[model samples]
Each structure stands twice: as C-alpha cells, then as structure tokens.
Target chain A: MGAVLLATILAIFTTMILALWRAIAGPSVYDTIVGVNVFGTKTVLLIALITYFSGNDDLIDVALVYALINFLAVIAVLKLIRQRDLAAAPEGGDD
Target chain B: MTELILDVVSGLLLLGGAAFAVIGGIGVMRFPDIFTRLHAGGITDTLAPLLIVGGLVLQSGFTLLTFKLLLILLFLLFTTPAASHATARAALVAGLQPVTRDSTDQKETRSSNS
Candidate 1:
C-alpha cells in the first residue's frame, strides 16, 4: 500500500510540473489563471495523499482549509479582472 | 484480499486523476485561446482532485480521515466550477477573444458591437 501511494504521489507531481509549464508559457492571462486553478487542485490531492501515507488524519483539516482558500482566491482574482476591464473601457462606449 | 484489492483500485484511480491533470495542462498550453483552455482546466480543477482524493480516502480505510477526505471533495465540487465560470466571464468582459481558426471576422464584429 505504501508503494502504491508513493507511485500515485509521483504521478501527481509530474502532472503539477506540466501545469507549471503551462502557467509560465500561457499567452493569455486567463490561461495562466487556468494553470493556477489546476495547480490548486493538484495541491489538494497531494495533501490528501500525504495524510494517507503519513498516517496523519490531522492533515485532512489543513487540506480542507487550503481547498477553501484556493477557491476564494480564484474568485477574487476574477472579480478584480472584471473591474479592471470595465474601468479601462471608454465612457459611454466600448472598444 | 480485500485490502489488497482496495489498494490496487485506489492506485489506479490516483493515476487516472494525474493523467487528467496533465492533459488539462496540455490543453491550457496548446489551445489557441482562453475559452477552450478554461474548459480543459475546469475538468482538471473539479474532477481530477475528486478522483485522487477518493483514492486516498479508500487507502485510508474507514476512519475519520476518510470523512475529512469526503469533505474536501465536497468543497471542491461546490467551488471549482464557480471559479471557472467567474474567470471565463471576466475574461469575456476583458476582451479576450475566443479563437476560431475560420471565424476571426465574427469575433471582430462582436467585439466591435460591445
């Protein structure tokens, strides 16, 4: 079981590296945002796996908190982008 | 025997989730525009974590840990899609055009009218 869990974690880490590549190379801002979202998801999974491997159920609460924080951050960034865009638009008209 | 079976199944699920996540990253990097990338990333954002967490819960067996894992999954399902939707809507409002190989003119027209 330990071996299996380790393999799973290794695979997840590989996926996270790929996501980091996308985040760095993304042409548009939203693509980067997508990459960040993927990263956050992977982090949540990693925490769960760690909890299993370390025999530490206490880490599960930390994982839950991270998940909640990640979601809220994404929403806040989205709102900021929208407000910035609206402010940039010409008064009484759009581009 | 049952424990062994559960371990194998959980390992497989974790692997599958990792695959989905990598594919989502590829989609984000290779897709021409924001909207399609969002679709791909959103899939990973919600489903991949759920799969991996589910696997970990199984590996943890019937413990309080399992319940906590389930809570994490529930929170992800509730929040991920909402975040993606908000991001996409914000991108649209910010003038990020949806790329179509054959429909550049349509996008221009739409943007012009906005």
Candidate 2:
C-alpha cells in the first residue's frame, strides 16, 4: 500500500528475476542450487513485507515457517547432489 | 513528531535493504563461479533481512507483531549462513572446484539454449 513497501516488493521481484537467470542458465548443477537458495531467501523477505503491508501479523508465522522450510530444502538438495555425484563416480581408475 | 521520526527511520532501513538485495542479485548473475555467487547471495540472506525485518519491527512497535518479526529475524540469522556453508561444502565434497585465477581455462557460461 505504501510507496516504500511497493518499491521494496518490486525490487525483490527484480532480484528474483536475476536469480531465475542462474537457475535456468547453469554451467554446473551447483549454480542451480545456489540460484534456488537465493530465490527462497527473497521469497521469505517478500512474505515478511507483505505481512506488514497487509497489517496481518498472522502471516509472520507463515514467513517463519517458510524460512525453516527453505533451510531444509537447501540442505536436502546439497545432500542429494553430493550423494548422486559420489554414486556416479567410478570406484576403479586406470593406472 | 515521534511518528515522523519512526517513519523516516523505517523508510531508510527498508530502502537500504532493498538496495542491498538487488545488488546481491545482480552480483549473482555477474560472478564467474558458484562460490563467488554464493558470496554475493550471502548479503541478501544476512544484511537485507536484518535491515528489512528491523524496519518492519520498528514500524510495528512493541507488540505481538514485533515479537513475530523478531522470530523471523532470529530464524533467518541462524539458518541462512548454515545453508550457505552446507551447500558450499557439499559442492566441494562432490568434486566441484572453483575456477583458478591464474589458469583462465574454463569459461563458465550460461546455457545457450536457455
């Protein structure tokens, strides 16, 4: 509703767009992981702003839950990627 | 008078947070390697939230809303860095190496089709 809040949200949207670039255009899988992580962080912030703008304090609880879930998502992705890489690696090598 | 001061202070903080977040985003696109991009992104995870949430907390004053804002900040402070560290370490464990400065061999580029 306020000018500042609206601008903040717009800036956040642009930030997400930049992160989307990384997610879609990656030389390595790690880039996508980083992109997704950054995007999640922005989403949390956006939710926080929305909560304040709407005067609905209840949404703060939602933001908190999202932050926790985002952390779990990153950890899970990293763990899975590491495991996949190890599995794909050859156990025996040529001398 | 106090309301005016509060409005000004919160406005400044919100603007600062937005500026930092967008800068970090641009850096994420510009940086050459995954590690460097993470460094850029870490700013958004930490500083932007600190400022933005702090601004919101100030706007809410001492109330249940402020408490919720504090909770959000606490969670952000504790988890964001942890996620970044875990992701970076996992990348290393998975045999992903940063591009060496001196060699200038591989050029990390976006997917052409995308």
Candidate 3:
C-alpha cells in the first residue's frame, strides 16, 4: 500500500511538472491561466496524498484551503485580465 | 481478505487517477489553442481529483480525515466548471477564437494577428 501511494505521488508530481511547463510556455493569456488552474487542482490532490503518506491527517485542512483559494484565485485573475482594472465596470455585455 | 481487497481497489483508483492527470497534462501541452487546452485541463481539474480523492477516502475508511477529504473533493466538483467557464468567456472576450475544422488554415493568421 505504501508503495502504491508513493508511486501515485510520483506520477502526480510528474503531471504537476507538465502543467507547470504549460503555465510557463503557454502562448495565450488564457492558456497560462488554464495551466495555473490545472496546476492548482493537482496541487490539492498532491497535498491530500502526501497527508496520507506522511500520516499527518491534519494536513487535510491544507488541501481544503488550497481548493478554495485556487478557485478564487483563478476567478480573480480572470476578472482582472478581462477588466484590466479590478475596480472597473463592465464595458459591454459579453465581458 | 476484505482489507486486501480494499487495498487493491484503492491502489487501482489512485493509479488510474494519476494516469488521468498525466494524460491531461500531455493534452494541455500538445493541444493547439487555449480552448482545446481548457478541454484537457478540465479533465485534470475534475476526473483526476475525483478518482484520487475518492481512492483516499476508501483507504481512510470513515475517519474525520475522510470527511475533510470529501469536502475538498466536493469543493473541487462545484468550482472547476465555474472556473473553466470564466476562463473560456474571458478568452472569448479577449478575441481568442476557437479552432474549428474549417478554421485550421485561419488559426495561424489569427493567432499571429492577436
């Protein structure tokens, strides 16, 4: 079971690296945002798995916090990117 | 016997989830445009977390930790799509067009112009 968990962790780490690459090299602003979002999701999963692996159940709270923050961060960044100023009003209907 | 079965099942789920994450990563890397990349990212954002966290829950077996993990899982379930929608909408608003079959030739010019 430990071996399985370790392997899973390693695999997720690899995926996280891949996501980081996309985040860094992505051509468009949206691509970068998508990469960051994916990375955050993986980070939460990684944290959860590590909590089990290290036998520190308390770290589960960190994973929960990560999930909430990641969602808000993505939304906030999108709003910022679209609005240019976070305090600005919507210029049109589509935006 | 039951413990062994549980262990095996959980292991499979964990591995499967990891595999999905890796595939989604590759898709994000190799996909042509932001819209397609979002499709790949969506896979990771949803299914990978579901499988990985669900497997963890199975291993924990009715503990407080399991409840917390479930909360994270449920939070992810509710938020990922909302994030994706906002992203796509933002991209559209930013003038990034989707790549369709007919737009294959136009993609390059459009991206270059953008």
Off by over 4 Å in 1: A84-95, B101-114
Model 3 chain A, TM-score vs. native: 0.92
Complex DockQ, candidate 1: 0.48
Lowest summed lDDT over 10 consecutive residues: which window, candidate 1 chain B? B105-114
Candidate 3, pairs of clashing residues = none
Task: Show model 2 residue runs off by greater than 4 Å.
Answer: A84-95, B102-114
For this target, which candidate reaches the highest TM-score against the unseen true structure? 3
User: What DockQ results do all the predictions give, each relative to the true complex?
Assistant: 0.48, 0.53, 0.84
lDDT of 2 by residue, B34-107 (tens): 88889998988899999999888778889987887788789888988888888787667667776456466565
Error of 2 at A53 (Å): 1.4
TM-score against native, each model: 0.82, 0.87, 0.93
TM-score, prediction 3: 0.93
Candidate 1 per-residue lDDT, tens place, A3-30, comes to 8778777876876787778778766667
lDDT of 1 at A35: 81
TM-score of chain A of 2: 0.84
Q: lDDT, candidate 1, residue B26?
A: 69
